[model samples]
Structure formats: C-alpha cells, structure tokens
Target: MIKRITDSSAASPGALCRLLWESMLELLYPSNIYCICCDNLIDDSRPYSLCDDCLTNLHWANERTCRCCGKILKEGYRWDICTDCSSASHSFEKGFACTEYGGAEKNMLLRFKFKEKAYYGEKLAEIMFDRIQPEELDVDLILPVPMHKRKEKRRGYNQAAILAYHLSRYMKIPFRKNILLRSRETMPMKGLGAVERRANIENAFTVSRGWDTIIKNKKILLVDDIYTTGSTADACADVLLAAGALRVYVLVFAAGANRTV
Candidate 1:
C-alpha cells in the first residue's frame, strides 16, 4: 500500500535511491514504459508518460472559448458563445475545460478511469488548475461529481473525488465530497443526443440530507473528468441550486467537440 508521507517520516536516502533505480530499470526494459497517449515506448526523461511525438500533437484548449461554457468557436465570433449556449438554459453559471476530448486526452481519461491509473488524476487536476484563475474563480466549496454507490464499490475509487482532493489542496479550498449524492445510476450518456442525455441524467442526483447545513448559500465549484453533453453537470447544478447554493461552476478536464448543452 502507498502510505501518505508525513513531515515526521520523510523518505530516507535509501528509499529514494531505490525508487530512482526502479524507475531507471523500468525505462531500460523495452516493454515497460508505454506512452499514455499512443502506447509507444517513451524515453526516460519525458515529463509525462506520453511520447514526445504525441505530446506535440496533444491539443490543449488555448483558443478563445465560450465565456459561459468554454466551447471553442470559429473566428469573428462575439465573446465565443457557441450556438448551444446561445439557445440552451444551463443551471451552472459557467464552466471551463482544459483540453479537447480526443487523442491524448481521451487515452489519459480512459487509463485513469478504467485501468485504475490513479496517478493520472494528479496530472489531470494540475492541467485543469493551470487553465483557471483561482482568485477569479473564488469558490466557497469544491465538490466532486459523485459516483453511484455501486459504481464506487466496483471501481474502488472515485476519479472525480481524487481530482477534487488535489484541486482543493492546490487552490486552498475546502473539498466537500459528501454534499452531492448520486441517487440513481442512469444509462451511459455516450452516443446519446443532448436532449436524451439531459433526460437520462435528470433527477439522477440529489443533495444528501443534512448536507444543506454545510453547503447552504456557498459558492461551489464542481469537479469532474469529462464534460460532454453538460447533462450530468446541469443535473448536479440544478440540485445544488435548489438546495440553496449561491452559485455553481464546473471544472472539467476535457470537453467533447461533438457534444453541446
């Protein structure tokens, strides 16, 4: 098991040396160090698990995006509000994504979620943090989009909670994991149209009883791995607002280009 390192029990020189040696050995072994993006062998000094070539191709969301939803748009647009935001009424005030959901980002999210690669959560959270302004996004509480009980039991971890923990630490905000509860497991939103996705997730989430005492009137930032149709976030935001939250905002690692509202 990986023990949390406390100040009193710092890593010893021998342990550090052993870790470095193991990392070097893994790099030397031809089959061990596979790229997180393309499953290709990566060189020893690469910062991320992705190979340099894949890193070059990685698409970061650097364009001027929607002020409300952060969807990248074509040039000559006014304030980057996409058609979806222009037409739809979303519950959350605004949201931002760090990257587009494709290529390197898709691979990373899959590994993090399905392969139980927990370390990727930290890297992903860091990337998400880098894209937002802490002061401007001053939130009273940080909440991870909750996983259903059965799903959490099966996976043994909630990726969104893990990401929220790191983000709370980095931003000096209080991370409240229990405020929002997934009341039911909805069908997967993949391949579903926006309206269908919304209906699927609608009423699937609820604020935990008594959580109102902790979250009432608080400005909350909801953290999640991906933003697709905005259904899940919208549902959660609706519940949170109904439960007396002053405002809600979402932070997601990636946004799908094909999805809107």
Candidate 2:
C-alpha cells in the first residue's frame, strides 16, 4: 500500500539529460542532413555534404592537358597544345576545368541540369574554386552563360548562374549574369556533331546594351557547367571580346572528351 518511487520516470535525471541532449542537437543542425550526391547521412564534420566515396570518384582533369582547352594529352605527347586545341581557334585566351565530363561527373551534371538538383552546383563550384586562380586570370568580373527568359523560367534556375555565384564568393570577384544575354534559346546541343554545335551556338549570344563599357578593357571570366567542343565557351567569349572586354577566359565544372582545337 506504500506509494512507489519511480526513479526512471520522465522527471528522472537520465530522462532529462536525454531530452536536453536531443534539444541541443536540434539547435545545432537540421533534422535531416544527408549527402547531396547519394543521400547518405553526412558526417557531422563533413563540410562538403557529400559522401567520401563520391568525392573520391570525381574524375579530376589531372593529366597532361592542353593549355588552351584542358583536355588530356596522349601519352608521349610533347606539344604544349593538344591536337584539338592546336587546330581550333578558341576565342577565349585559356579555359580550365576541374573534372572530365564522363562517368560519375557526367551523371551529376545531367542531374544538376534536368533533375532539379541545382544544389549540386555547390560541390562543383568548390572543386573549380581550387583549380582557378582568379588573381592570375586577373578577371575584373565574373559572367555566367545566360539562359533565355523562357528557358530559365522553365528550368527554374540557370545552373551556370548558381556556379558563377559560388565562384564569385570564393574569388571575391563581382558576378554579372545579365551582361551577356542568350539572344535566343536554340535546340538542345546534345549529340550534335562539332560542326553542328558551332552552328547551333554561332551568334547565339550578345552583350547587353550600355553595359559594354563596364567590361571594356577589363578582363572577364566566363563561367559554365561543362566545356564540350569549346563552341559554347568560344561563342560567349566572342561576344565579350566584341563588347571590348580586354580578355575573356573560361572556367567550367567538367571538360568533355571531344575537344576541338
């Protein structure tokens, strides 16, 4: 008949400690943090928010590469420029990339573009941030490949713009998305031959009116998601140079296997 003392009840010190511990966790981080690539639970200390395996699988463009286009050179190759770069007339002074455009890298880019995975740009930009030395490029401003109004509306966001924004923050350079405009949205360039790619993007871009003076005589870095045949970068570079930009350099997250000199 004596009243029992329930020491393990909600009011007990052990229960209170667990509650406080959970509350502190809630205060420290989001309820559901996961890796951006594989959706695995990210370790508390992993700043990249991507699993280590995915990070390891990222194909860094770390071979003897073309100085102009950054494509992997054949073994025993001695030329500073690869065959593709030596043959092509690239408008940009130089182009750089963090990874080759295939395998896991290709899949990630495809998702970032068409699968509403825009946040993937964060990791891509981080990778490129280490590869690009903005001071050496001496870029006055950063510009992203613009999307046409209708296309941007349909896509919800421009992947290139997201990358340029992160790149700007890393390099402490100003970013301008509107300076260079995509005059019109053309058909998708996927599977297009090199010549077709060039034709597809030719004259597809122009500098916005009145803003040309700002970039005139000032170096510019053009940002994009991928560098395929260099046609897109070249096209954008041509427009910037035409607008009097002192020099236009290109930076991309991935470099395609097909390189045109």
Candidate 3:
C-alpha cells in the first residue's frame, strides 16, 4: 500500500511553501536534524522529531489509569474506575489519553495551545496515534471538537482540529471537520467543578444539518487537545449521539490530573 503524507498542515499554501524550502535545504545540505521542542541539533537517523533529552523528559500516560477515561489513579488505589468516571455519565464510550497534565507536559501543551507553537501538534499527534491504534477503535470518521468562529478567527487555527486532520490522514479515516459545530464560545473550564463545567458547556455544540445521514450508525473518534472534566467532549458527543452515531470514542493529548488537593 502507498503511504499518504499525514501532516495536514503541509496541505495549506503557506505550509506547502515551507515544505518546498525544507525539501530544497535537505537536498543541498544532505543532513541536518532539529529537535521538535528545543530546536537543538539531533542525529539524522532518529525517526521522531524530538531530541533524546526532550524525549527522556516528556511524560507518558503510563500509570494504572481508569478504563473509561484514562486518568491516572492515586497510588494504593486499586479500582480501575477513576473518581470522576465513577460518579459521572460521559456520552462517549471510552477515552484514550496520552500524558499527565503537569510539569513539562503541561508546559508543552500550554505552548501548543496558547503560544501558537503549531508544529508541536504534529509530534503530539504522532504520539497519540501510536499509542491508540485507529483500526482498533473501528471509527468510521475522526471529528475534532470544533471551535467557535470568533475564537478561531483570532487564534488563526484550532489546535484540536490540527491533530484530528493528521490523525485522519495517518489512520486513513475520513475527517469531516465542519460536521460538528461549536455553536458558541465558552469561558475556560479551568478551576471549575465537574458539575459547573458541564453547565458551562451545556448546549455549546451542535451537529451540522444534513450530515445526519453520514454520521448515523457510524463510529466516531472525537479528538481534542485536553480532557479536563470532559465537559466539552460530553457536550459534543451528546449531539453526535442524538444525530444517531452508534458510539463516540475520545482521544486526547493529555488529561487533567486527579490531584489530592
């Protein structure tokens, strides 16, 4: 089978020009490697973009995590279901999270979203897709949680949508971006309780009209940058379910920590 290039950013005109320049550089110099995070020189033989130091420092979601949401459990906690998942009802069937939301991981995500370190998304997507096999999810389509038009206009990109696009191409699953629409903008859900978060995001999303036929009975993988209380995911999934999606699965870059505070 032929391999399709999965860096969706490269599809855009600006990105295409950059890719051409990089191609020319590679041809002329023959060898140069840069770290995905620090821009430090790296060995050309490395398969991933991250340098060894950065790779060693990056945190992976490798704890004894919850079955439903993938949140890391506190030590000596034997239950598979996390506190949040146990008490709440999530519209999605399951979730796969890639890293803890703390320290270097948290800093990197903040940079990815707030600082517009856009290329970081490609590395995050590569990690997420590697950890959770798309074929295993059996999803017919990949849908990134949508952003409100106003916010997206200022931001110039929806970070989650970037991840979803790359995932769709790498996994060879169809991606329909506009099918799931964010009807309104929401305040940041940070520091809110689960109930408040759910309320804050309620009715924030809707499935686009005339797309019901395409989504009906199809399995969908909902993509996002982070999973906090899952309020955003639930709101999005609820609409998809209402539109007759068979089930929705979630994949995220990181999960909010289950702190003891």
Q: Which predicted model would earn the best TM-score?
A: 3
Model 3 per-residue lDDT tens digits across residues 49-129: 667877777667776888988777778886788878877878899988888776767767777777655556666788889
lDDT of 1 by residue, 175-206 (tens): 87778999998888888888999889988999
User: Candidate 3: misplaced stretches above 4 Å?
Assistant: 1-32
Tell me, what's the RMSD of every candidate? 6.5, 12.8, 3.9
The TM-scores of all predictions, comma-separated, are 0.81, 0.82, 0.85
**Weakest 10 consecutive residues, lDDT, candidate 2?**
1-10
Clashes of each: 0, 3, 0
Candidate 2 clash pair list: 84-261, 87-261, 88-261
* Runs of candidate 1 exceeding 4 Å displacement: 1-35, 39-50, 75-79, 258-261
Worst 10-residue stretch by lDDT in candidate 1?
Answer: 1-10
Q: lDDT, candidate 2, residue 116? A: 56
Clashing pairs in 1: none
TM-score, model 3 to reference: 0.85
lDDT by residue for model 2 over 86-107, one digit each (tens)?
Answer: 7778999988887777787777
Alpha carbon lDDT of each predicted model: 0.75, 0.75, 0.77
